[model samples]
Target: MDWGLVGILLLMGAGGGFAAGLLGIGGGMVLVPFITMIFTAKGFPPQVVVHMAIATSLATIMFTSLSSVRAHHKHGAVQWRIVALLAPGIVVGSWIGPWIGKQMNTSALSLLFAAFVTFSALQMILNKKPAPGRELPGTPGMFAAGGVIGVVAGLVGAGGGFISVPFMTWCNVRIHQAVATSAALGFPIALSGTLSNIYFGWSEPGLPQYSLGFIYTPALAVIVAASVTMAPLGARTAHKMDVVSLKRAFAVVLFGLAAYMFYHAFA
Candidate 1:
């Protein structure tokens, strides 16, 4: 549609994708809140824009996660066994979480999202010197963790890396591998969340033009293009730099964003 809008979308995707790889975040943590602001500025109905932004963000994350996961897999950083064990729970939880989220007020959702962002930032800052080795959670336990992560993912339109990495680390998986596995898990979270967004928005009318259910096509196009291309670069950067330093920097950024979001929601 509009070339200018397309450009913005691409930049958003690239930036979000790069951050996802570099910071071990799902990218949604950055993308959703920002996209919501964009939609708000465009004069979309405030009540609906937040949901649309989050849903579109999840859709874009689906692609970014693939790129990030592949890069991690190549480096032997992904834990396939864990991904397999957790996917079922993630899929089911992701599907249900959005349904519940759709019923909540816009301000409440934004506040919840802000809290999650702050928590993620704190976790990154605190998780310096990870624990020892990998511990395989049996089927039941893995599913439990996945379900929790999935529900959150659905509500926030996130990759769940914010929660997944720590959970994996707590289970004794190495930090790098935990981030990688979390990246892979994002794919399922995005897929289920996207579907749920569509379901939730299917009957509603009078949305902004160029939207497909809850996803705004223009934004999705931009985000997917930029993020997919640059995510690998972030993965590469992770290899070159000191992880603790990067994590600290990432935490600062998250804190700033969280503060901005809190203001946006309340003010």
Candidate 2:
């Protein structure tokens, strides 16, 4: 890999990993938009740039998730029972989501991606703390929630934390537990989506040289290496900081990026 490219990847990873830890937002919310800009600058076809970015983000998330989950698990923050309950549905649904996304036109896919990010941001802004006495959703309900989050993960090549964390919190899991369990789920989301994107995009004509299906390997390598170290750092900071303002700041950033993508997709 080019040293310059590796440097870029490391920077991306650091930013993504830190945000993942701090906000409990899927790193994809940050990763996808920035990666798309890189793809565009690299002379990648506009139609496929978002797909490539999403695919690459999923690949990077595989590593970032592992690091973040390790940190969270070390603190005994993860709810393993919930992970077991949700894994089956998440695995199946995540695998299918990206395959379907890959089949759509790139413009449609980008718009859909932007819409999803916008909705997630809105949800973050609007959702309030659940009542103290809230109860865990039953096993069946957890499975259904997992399926929904899986589809979102697949469609956008995200870690699914935005959906999963909120769902867990709504089900009466504490905030930290929700964040940890969601981190655990990130591996499955990234693994399933990356594999599906590979299958769906394989043999497609005129794809950039050295790309693995939808994923660009050098980009993935850069993003993963940097994000691993930084994500844990971000999580540590999140624990020490007041996060409401941070969430809003991230939301503004996401909205601005989404708008730029919308212009690129349409103009």
RMSD of each: 1.8, 1.9
**Candidate 1: tens digits of C-alpha lDDT, residues 1-267:** 578767776777887898877766778888887788788888887877778888998898789888887888888998898899999999999998888888987788888888988988887788654464557678998898899999999998888887788778877887788888888899999999899888888776778888888889877877787899998888778666767877778788889888877887786
Estimate every model's Cα lDDT from 0 to 1: 0.83, 0.81
Over 4 Å off, model 2: 1-6, 130-134
What tens digits encode model 2's per-residue C-alpha lDDT throughout 1-267? 567767776777888889887765558878888888778888887767888888889888788888887777778888999999898889888888887787787788888888988887776666566554666677788778788888889888788887787777767788888888888888888888889889887877778988999899978876777888887887777667678877877778888878876776686
What is the Cα-based lDDT of residue 210 in candidate 1?
81
TM-score of each: 0.93, 0.93
Pull out the clashing pairs in model 2.
9-222, 13-227, 17-231
lDDT of 2: 0.81
